[model samples]
Target: MCISNPNSISDQTDLVAMKARLWALLRKEEHEWLQKSRLKWFKEGDINMKFFHLTASSRAKRNQISKLKEIPVKRLSVGSRRLLERLFSEEEVWNMSCRLCLIEDSSFNNSFISLIPKIDEAVSPEDYRPLSLVGSLNKIVSRVMARRMASCLKEVVGENQFAFIVGKQIVDCVLIANEVIDDLSKKKKKL
Candidate 1:
């Protein structure tokens, strides 16, 4: 009817309004269909076959452990009686340290490298911090060595070395340097 009356502006406006209403109703119906599809029918089987397949394949890939390297297990020569000894002697500590250094067994030195993200969404290599998860035996040995060397640490290391010392901090050195700089720059220096 609007096509027949081409010059009627009122008719053209009414036609446009009707078309808009139809389009709105069509969109509403499509949204309802999408919601209904997601609720009940989607549980039985997905309407979007491509999307379902993609999700399934991605999940499978994520779950699958690919190219896992074989780690060979080796038995230690040390007896269980000596290994489980509660008392620590100088000889035992020395022996353990020497054995750890010379041992070809990967189990003693094996470590898992875990990447911890520095930011919420890590993009590059620099965004992650690599943390090594070492074996319990290795940690025990390291702790024992550290404890043994802690007494001699102050004697071996100088007073100027503020890092890795139990009683000292690097911030102390920074504060001292700042004070020295301030004193040196003064008109009447007392440094």
Candidate 2:
């Protein structure tokens, strides 16, 4: 009763076109959903969405397969080195305070030199947070003290030898060792 239609090529082409249109619509919807999901995820935390997306797909993986791929790098200069040193020293002093509290009250002589690297590792980039106003002020004071100490070192020794001394690196030490005594004295008004 039914005969085979040899002119079914047009009908097959229509079906293929419909399928392609449906696939495009579905892909658009999926992309919108992904963008919304990524926005929500980033809003929940400090996750960098761009980094997440770049590392999410296989296409990105293939692009990164080459060793010559562009990689961002920041070279640390003398100022940055000094800042890092000060941060490390301050963290060390804080940890040492904790150890001192555990031992004798107000004790400064503790055998805890090895704890510096541990503290540094614990306070990684992910754990870093913005400093408060008071903390920033304290850091400024420390830096000024460090600069003064370096100047004093240069006077005692020579400029060439003291040139290697990081201003921020010696700030805490200078402040604690009474090198900033005159500066503090000037701050105290007679009652």
Cα RMSDs of all predictions? 20.1, 23.8
lDDT of 2 by residue, 8-112 (tens): 887767777888999999999999999998787777534676765665675677867465768654455566456445544565455544543433444323222
lDDT of each: 0.74, 0.55
Say which candidate scores most in TM-score. Answer: 1
lDDT of 1 by residue, 1-191 (tens): 43778678988898898999999999999999999977865774577777788888999999999888887534332453344344667775666666556444657657789999999999999999999998746765776656655644655466668977997999998999999888778946544
Each candidate structure's count of clashing pairs: 0, 0
TM of each candidate vs. truth: 0.36, 0.21
Q: Candidate 1 — which pairs collide?
A: none
